[model samples]
Target: MKILPYHPSVLAQAQLVDLINYCQNTEAHLAIKMAEQADIFAIPQVYQQSGGNFWIAQDAQQIVGCIALLPLDAHTGVLKKFFTYPPYRGQPVRLGAQLFDQLLNFAQQHDFTRLVLDTPAAETRSHTFYEHHGFRRITPNELAVAYSYPDRHSWLYELQL
Candidate 1:
């Protein structure tokens, strides 16, 4: 698999939506929510335009995963759209770990001191992943004003880079 940064087809890639849909379906009845589903159609504007980036994990010809980094302010960034096609998630594949490394490298290189993210409480695997990477659970009040989360009720995690 290869991790590629910045693709114009992000908005046109059906697999991107398919991957997101796959994740949602796993916890379809949960309280997980998005501020605006249409935001996917404006990735560059919502993310990159704010001095952040989006990445895709492609396996040969297929898109296996994706993640977005959105700057909350000069020193903070929030992760978004982090998803991995189930079959490539763990073990020898380690696609999620690789994607996470990319995000961390980017965060550090960009001089971001802290990284924040929200995961659906139902996604225990994701919670474990974040914690393993040094993220600690934090309250919403601990977040900055620029931090606007789509998941109204999510487990918040923050890592000080």
Candidate 2:
């Protein structure tokens, strides 16, 4: 797989729409959130000012994965939208590790010292992925303002870079 710079709105939407469709197949929530939209809109601004970077991964010619970096503070940041296609999920942790490494390298180059992210409370796969990369679980919080939805609360995670 090859990773390249990509604007989140370019292919991330299709991936997310695919996730929404997949969720629908399992009777899950399908509402889009402002947080996601804000992230999408901020990618360019972040890139311009050194606060964020977005990447796309491809297999052959298809976009199979994506990740984004967003600053949480001058010395800290957040990693968001890290995803890979379902068919490629069985690969070694290297994929996520590499993507995360890239983000961390960026943070290091920018003087960031920590990073934070949130994942769904029940997404065991994601929890494991984050844990394998040295993230620790923090107290779970109801992100009613960021998520703004009663049923889609998330557990927060953090990684020191």
The model with the greatest TM-score is 1
Q: Which residue pairs clash within candidate 2? A: none
TM-score of each: 0.90, 0.73
Question: How many clashes show up per model?
Answer: 0, 0
Segments in model 2 whose C-alpha atoms lie over 4 Å from true places: 7-38, 46-50, 92-94, 140-151
Please identify model 1 stretches exceeding 4 Å from their true place: 10-12, 26-35
Query: Can you list the residue pairs that collide in candidate 1?
Result: none
| lDDT scores of the candidates, listed in order | 0.82, 0.65
> How do the residues 1-161 of candidate 1 rate in per-residue lDDT, one tens digit apiece?
78987566744367777777778765345523343566677777888788889888988867889998998889999988888988887898989999999988999999999999988787788988899889999988887646666674689999998
